[model samples]
Target: MTTLDKRQRVANPTYEPQPYSVTGYPTFRSFYPYYLGEHAHPVCLVGTTISLSVFVRALLAVLPLLSPAKQFAALRFGTQGWKSVGKLLLGGLLQGYVWAWIGHFFFERNKPATFKHPFYSLLGDLTLWKEVATLKRRP
Candidate 1:
């Protein structure tokens, strides 16, 4: 096909996002073991911890300014409130992405497993935090 014809045709017109799932292990318990293995690198531990810490700090800074009821209100109701939350969310996401990419590419020298297992990876992160807090694991 000519370049012009290719440009005119729709690319992936039927594209749709599929639900995330792990093979074999349908539950978090079944997947936790594999998740831990992926995050064995020290960099992954520190990266995810810093990312989550930033998010919590941001949320705490803005919590006092917003009433519980206003939390669910539209962004227009309280611009400051929404902006604070937005900043936290964006900052946390950016930090997480950057740290994960750096850790995987430089420290671990492997592609992040999150690419193939998002949900499980997320849960694994939280589980890691729990383990650290309970003195079951070190970061």
Candidate 2:
């Protein structure tokens, strides 16, 4: 299992924060390696995939309400449609975080990258999701 072996090599037994997560990087290219390092467990990668899937579904839900012909006319159901969109967004966000956090706490045995670098962590999560979804990266 080279995948697990490689991930194991990346994982540190100590749960202490790594120096990479502590400092600000000038570009996402630098932060991406650290992001991949944090998801050292297969479960962590699975969590990321599920989280992004939920986001994709949420976007799909809103697309139906959008009117491509005009601006400020996205809601076909008027105010009610806006309310549904809000709830869908909120639900997706909360659910997605829960899965990611569970992966960190249980399988990874470490803190999430989001704790130190929110922006890059988000980018990493999306990137991981894309890779996994497209079968470009193995679980």
- The lDDT leader among the candidates is 2
Candidate 1 regions exceeding 4 Å error are 1-24, 67-80
The residue ranges of model 2 lying beyond 4 angstroms of the native Cα positions read 1-23, 67-79
lDDT per model, in order? 0.63, 0.66
lDDT of 2 by residue, 7-80 (tens): 44432322223457355788887777667767756676665566566666667657656756555354233256
| Model 1 weakest lDDT span, ten residues long | 10-19
Clashes of 2: 0
Residue 57 displacement in candidate 1 (angstroms) = 1.8
Q: Write the per-residue lDDT of candidate 1 for residues 27-112, one digit (tens) a residue.
A: 77766665655555667767677778877776665655655666634433235766867777788878887888888788766676
Colliding pairs, model 1: none
